[model samples]
Target chain A: MTPRLFQRTASAVLVVLITVSVLFPLAWMAIAGFKGRNEVLRSPFQFFPDMWRFDNYVDIARDPEFTRAMGVTFAGALIFTALSLVVNSLAAYAFARLEFRGKRFWWVYCVMPMFIPMMAILLTSFMVVTKLGMLNTMAVLIIPGVASGAQMFFIRQFYLGFPVAVEEAAMIDGASRWQIFLKLFLPQSAAPFVVMGIASYLAFWNAYVWPILTITDPNLTQIMQFLGTFRSARGNDWGMLMAGSTLASLPTILLLLVFQRFIVNGVRISGIK
Target chain B: MALTPTLAPGPQTADAGRSARGRRGRVKTPPHRRDNRTAYLMIAPMVILLGIFVMWPLVYSVYLSTYEINFYRGSTFVGLQFYRYVLESPDFWHSIVVGLYYSALTVPAMIIIALLLASFIKTLSRRAAAFMKTTVYLPTVVSTVVASVLFVLIYQDEGVANWLLSLISFGPVNWLNDPQLALPAIAVPGIWLGFGLTTLILLAALLDIPESYYEQAALDGAGFFARLWYVTLPLLKNVLLYLFVTGFTLAIQMIDLPLIMTNGGPSEATNTPNLYIFNTFRDVTPYATSYSLTASLLLFVVIGAISAVVFRLVRSDKAIDG
Candidate 1:
C-alpha cells in the first residue's frame, strides 16, 4: 500500500476503536436496563438480555419519590436557566455596551467568582443561605446559583463581538435605550442566550453536592442526589440501578441529539474565547 | 417645519431638546450619561446577587475558618487554631496528596489520548469526522452521577471490564474495592468523561493552524512525525497549556464520581480534597466546620497560585501569531 493509503486505513481503525470504547458503557447500561437481575449479574458479558423486562421502569414510575425527584430536577433546571439568562445577560449587556462609573471595578468583581473554586465557598455559602432562612427549600437550590460569573463572562464576550451600528440606528430612530436593547440587542443575542441557558440548565440538573447538603426532605431530592441514595438503598438491584441511570441520562442524551450543533458551538466558543 | 412642534414639542422645550440631541450626536455626554444610568439599572440584580452569594461568602469563609463552632452551643473565636490544626492533620495532607496524584494520573493521560484522537479525526473525511466527534462527545453531556453509576456496573468483579480482561487470560480483579487499584480505577471514568472535551478543544486549535506550515514542512521532505513535532505541536503550545491548567483545576475538584462509586472507601485511597471537605462538614464534629473551611481555603490558595503561574507561562510565549 502507498503511504497515504496506510495512513488512512490506520486512522479508520483508530476511529472505530474509539467509537466502540466511548459507546460501550452507555450502550451496555441502556441494554441492562431491560434485563432481569439474574440476567444482569449472571451474564455480565452478554450483549443481549435473555428476556426483556419493563419491571424496572414500571417500578421507577410507580415510586413517588423517584417521580418527585425528576420533577424537582426539571423545575430546578428551568428556573435556574431562566434566572441565569436574565441576570447574566443584563450584566453582560452593560459590560459590553454601556458606560458607567466603577464599571471596571464591577466587571472585575463579577468575574472574580470564576477564579475561586465553588468548593472553597460551599460551607460558608450554606451558612449564608441558612442565615437568610432559605435553607432546606427549593429556593436554596436556585437562588445562590442564579448568578454565574462564567456565564456572564461568555455572554459579555458574545456581546462585545456584536456591532454597535444597529443600536445606533435604533437610537437615531428615536428608540429609547431599553427599546433598542429589547428589540435589537436581545434579538441578535439568541444564540449566546441559548448557549448559556443550556449550560445553566445542565449545571442545575447535574448538581449533587449542593442539593444534597441543602435538601433534607426526601420529596425535594434532586435526581443526582436521589440516585446516590437510591443506589445505597437498593444496592443489590442492578436492574433498577441501570434503569435509574438510564432515566437520569435520557434528558441529556436527547438534548445532545437535538442540539448537537448548538452544544458543540457553545463549547468551542466558550473555550476558544 | 409644521411638524417641528409636534416632533420637538413647545418652543422652549424644542430648543432644549435640539441642544440635547446635538450633544448626543456629537459629544459623548448626553447619551453616555443616560446609558450610565441604564447600565447601573441593568447590572443591579447581578451586583446584589454576587454581593450576597459570592463576595460575602468569600469573606465569610475566611472568617469562619478562624472560629470553632458547635451546633449545640454558641461559637467562639479560635484565631489561627483551625488553620494550624488542619496543617498538622495527616488526613488533610493525605487528601491533598491524593488530589495531586489523581491530577497527575488523569490530566496527562487525557491530554495525550485526546490529542491523538483529535489529530486522527482531523485526517478523516468530513462525514467520518462528524460521526467520530458526536460519538466521542456524547459522554460529555452525561451527568457525573449517571456516568459513575454506569461505570460501577462495568467495573464490578464480574463486569465487562474483567470480562474483557479474561479474553486476554487475566484473572478477575476488583476495580473499586481494592485500595491500590481504586484511585486508578476511578480515573478511568474521569478520563472517559474528560477526553471528549479535551479532544474538541484540541481539534479546534488544530483547525486554527494554517495549512501553509504543513505544506512548507512537506516541501522540505519532513515525515509525518517530523511535521507533527516541528509544525503542529509548536503551534498548539498555548492550547496545550490551557488544557493542562483547566484539566488540573477540574481534576482536583473531583467529587461526584468517587463519592458515588467508591464513597472514598477502600481505606480512603480515593479521598480527594473536595470529598474530604464534604465529609468533614457532614460529620458535624466540634471543629468540623472550621476544619472544612480551612481545608477549602488552603485548596483555593494552592489552585490560585498554580493557575497564576500557568497563565503567566502560557501568556509570556506565543507560538502562533494571529
Candidate 2:
C-alpha cells in the first residue's frame, strides 16, 4: 500500500479498537441487565443472552426505594440547576457589565472556591449543614450547591464577550438596567445558560459523597447512593445490579447524546479558557 | 458634543441643547452610582451563599482542626496537637504516599494515551471522528458509581478481565481483593473514565493548530514526526501542562472510585488521602473530628502548594507566549 493508504488504514484500525474498548463495558452492562444471574456470573464473555428479561426493569421500577431515590435525584438536579443559573448569572452579569467598587476583590472571592477541592471541605460543609438542622432534607443538597464559583466564572466569560451595544441601545431608550437585563441579556445569552444548566444538572445528579453523607433517610436518598448501597447489599445479584446501574445511567447518557455538542463546548470553554 | 448638530433644533434650540447635554452628563454620573447599587444587589445572593458555605467552612475547618470535638460533649481546645498527631501517624503518611502513587500511575498514562487517541482521531474522516468521539466520551457521562459497579463486575474472578487473561493462558488474578493489585486495578477504571475528557481537550487544542503550519512544515521537507514535534508539540505545550495539572489534581482527590470498588480494601492499599479523611471522620470517638480535620488541613495545604506552583508555571508559559 501507498504511505497515505497505510496511514489511513492504521488510523481506522486504531479508531475501531478505541471504540470497542470504550463501548464494551457499557454494552456488557446493558446486556447483563437482560441476563439471568447465573448466566452473568458463569458466561462472562457471552455476547448475548439466551432470552431477554424485561422483569429486571419492571422490578426496579416497582421498587419504592429506587423510585423515591430517583425522584429525589431528579428534583435535586432540577432545583440545583435553576437556582444555580439565577445566582451565578446575576453575579456574572454584575462582574461583566456593572462597574462597582471592590469588583476585583469580590471576583477573586467568588472564584476562589473553584480551586478548593470539594472533598477537602466535606466534613465542615456537613457540619454547616448539620448546624442549620438541614440534614436528611433536600435543602442540604440544594442550598449548598446554589452558588457555584465555576458556573459563575463560565457565565462571566460568556457575558464578557457579549456585545455591550445591545444593552447600551436599550439604556438609550430609557430602559432600566433590570429591564434591559431581563429583556435583552437573558434572551441573547440563552445558549450559555442552557450549557451551564445542563452541566450543573448532570453534576447534581451524579453527586455521591455529599448525598451519601447527609441523607440517611431512604426516602431522601439520591440515586447514586441508592444504587451503591443496593449493590453492596446484593453483591452477587449481577443481573439486578446491572439493571439498576443501567436505569441510573440512562438519563445522563440520553442527555449527553442529545446535547453532545453543547457539552463538548462547555467542557472546552471551561477547561481551556 | 461633536454630534450635537445632528439633532433637530427647536424654538429654544441653543439653551435646550445645552441643558440636554448637561442632563446627559448628569444622567451618566448617577447611573455609575446606580450601577454600583445594582451590582451589589445582583451579587448579594452569591456572596452570601459562598460566604456561608465555602468561606466560613474553610475557616471553621482550620478552627476545628485545633479542637477536640465530641458528639456527646462540646468542643475543647487542643492547639496543634491533632496536627502533630496526624503528622506522626503512619496511616496518614501511608495514605499520602498512596495518593501520590495513584497520581504517578494515572497522570502520565492518561496524558500519553489521551494524546495518542486524540492525534489518531484527528487523522480520521469527519463522520468517523464524530462517532469515535461520542463513543469514547460515553464513559465520562457514566457516574463514578456506575463505572465502579461495571468494573467490579468485570474484575471479579470469573469475569471478563480474567476471561481475557485466560485467553493468554494466565490464571485468574485477584484484581481488587489483592492488596498489591488493588491500586493498579482501580487505576484502570480511573484512566478509562478520565482519558476521554483529556482526549477531547487535546483534540480541541490540536484542531486549533492552523493547517498552514503543517503545510509549511511539509514544504520544509518535514515528515510526520518532524511536523508533530516542531509544529504540534510546541503549540500543544500549554494544553498538555493543563491536562497534567488537572489529571494530577483529580488523581489525588480520588474518592468515589476507590470508595465504591475497593473501599480501600485488602489492608488499605488503595486508601487515598480523601478516603483516609473520610474514614477518619467515620470514626465515632471524641477525638476523631480533630484528627480528620487536621488531616484535611494537611491535604488542603499540600494540594494548595502544588496548585500554586502549577498555576505559576502556567502563568510563566503565558508570559513566554505573549
Candidate 3:
C-alpha cells in the first residue's frame, strides 16, 4: 500500500480502537447484568451469559430502599437545580446587566465556589451541616450546592452572550431593571437555561459524597448512592452489582439518547470543552 | 421630561414634593431608583446562598486549618500547628507522590491518545465526525460512580479479563486487588473517561490550525511526527499547558472510583486525599463525619499546596509570556 493509504488505514484502526476502549467496558457491564453467577466467572469465550438472569432486576427493584433512593435523587436534583437557577441566575443577571456597587466583588464571590476544591471545602462544610443539625435530609444536600460556581458561570455566560438591544428597549418602555431581567433577558436565555438545567440535573443525579456525607439514613439516599452500597458490601455479587449499575445508568443513557444534541451544545457552552 | 422631576436636583425643591403631599392625597412616588434596587434584590438569593454555603465554609476551612482542635468533639486553639503536622505527615507526603503519579500517568497518556484520535477523526466526513465525537463524549455524562461500578464488574476476579486470558493461555492479572497494580488499574479507567474530552478539545483546536503550516510541511515531505513536533506542538503549547493544569487538578481529587470500586482498598493503595478525608470524617459518624479537626486541617494544607502549585504554573507561564 502507498504511504498515504497506510497512514489513513492506521488512523482508522486507531479511531476504532479508541471507540472500543471507551465503549467496551460499558458493553461488558450490560453483558454482565444479564449473566448468571457461574457464567460471570466462566472462560473468556463464554463471557456472554448462557442464560440471562432476570431475577436480579426484580430483586433490586423489590428492595424498598432503592425505590426511596429514587425519590431522594429526584427531589434533590429538582429542588437544588431550581434553587440554583433562581439564586445564581439572579446574581449572574445582576452582574451581567446591573450597575451595582461592588459589582466586581459580587462577581468574584459568586463564582469563587468553583475554585474551593471540594476536598478543601467538604471537610468544613460537613462540620457546618452537622452543627446546624440538618443531617439525613436532602434539603441540606440540595441547598448548599444551589449556589454553585459552574451554574453561576454558565448562567452569566448566557446573560453576557445576550444582546443589549432588548435591555435598551426595555429601558425605553420604562421597564424596571428587574422587569427587564424577568420579562426580557430571561426569555432570551432559554438556550443556556437548558444547558445549565441539564448540567444541574446530571450533577445532582450523579452526586454521591454529599448525600453519603450529610444523610446517613438508608432511606434518603439517591439511586446512585443506593447502587454504591454494592461497593462496600461483603463479597460483591458481580451479576447483581452490574444489574444495579445497569439500571442506575439507564436514565442517564436514556437522557443522552433523547437530548444528545442539547447536551453537546450545552457542554460546548458550559466549558466542558 | 416628566422623569426629570423625579430627580429633584435643587436642594430648595427637594422638600417641595414632601410639602405638596398634603395637597395631593395621591402622593407623588418618591424618586424611585427601582432599577438598582431590583438588581440588588434579584442577586440577593445567590449572594446569600454562596456566602453561606461556599464562601463562608471555605473561609471556615482555612480558619480551621490554622487551629489545633478535634472536629468530632471539642478542643483548644493552637495556631499553625496543624499545618506543621500536615507538612510533617508521611501519609500526606505519600499522597503528594501518589497524586503526582496519577497525574503523571493520566496527562501524558490522555494527550497522546487525544492527539491520535483527533488526527484520525479529522480525516472523517463532517457528519461522521460529529457522530464519532458524540459517541466518545457520551461516557463523560454518566455519573462517575456508575462508570466506576461498571469497570469494577469487568475487572473482577474470574470475570471478563480472566475469561479472555484463558483463551490466550495467559494468567488472569489481578487487575484491581493487587497493591502494585491497583493505582494503575484505577488510573486506566480515569484515562478512558478523560480521553474523549481532551480529544474533542484538541480536535476543535486542530481544525483552527492554519492550512499553510500543513502545506509547508507536506511540501517538505515531513513525516507525521515531524509535522506534529514542528507544527502542532508549538502552536498548542498554551492550550496543552492549560489542560495539564486543569486535568491535573481534577485527577488529583480522584474520589468516585476509589469510593465505588476500591474505597482505597487492598491496603489503602488507591486511597486518594479526598477518600482519606472522607474516611477520617466518616470513619465512624454518619453525618458528623468531619469531626476530626486535625484531619480537616491536614486536608486543607494538602489541597492548598496543590492549588498553589497549579496557580504557580499558570503564573509562571504568564511571566514567561510577559
What i-RMS does every model get?
Answer: 14.3, 14.4, 13.7
DockQ winner among the candidates? 2
Judged by whole-model lDDT over C-alpha atoms, candidate 2 comes out at 0.81
Tens digits of per-residue lDDT, candidate 2, B23-102, equal: 34544455445577888999999999999888888889998888888777878898999989999999999998999999
Q: Model 2, stretches more than 4 Å misplaced?
A: A1-9, A271-273, B1-34, B318-322
lDDT of each: 0.81, 0.81, 0.69
All models, DockQ values? 0.46, 0.47, 0.41
Q: Rank the candidates by lDDT, best first.
A: 1, 2, 3
True contacts kept of 3: 0.46
Task: For residue B73, give model 1's deviation from the true position in Å.
Answer: 4.3
- Tell me the lDDT of model 2 at B257: 91
Model 1 lDDT per residue over A1-273, tens place:
999999888888888888887898898988888988777867448878888889988897778888889988898788888988899889988877776777769988887777778888888898899899997788898989888777887777677667778778887889987787788778888778776776777788888888888888887889988887776776778888888888888887787777777755765565462
lDDT of 3 at A184: 82
Candidate 2 CAPRI-style tier? acceptable
* CAPRI level of candidate 3: acceptable
TM-score of each: 0.92, 0.92, 0.85
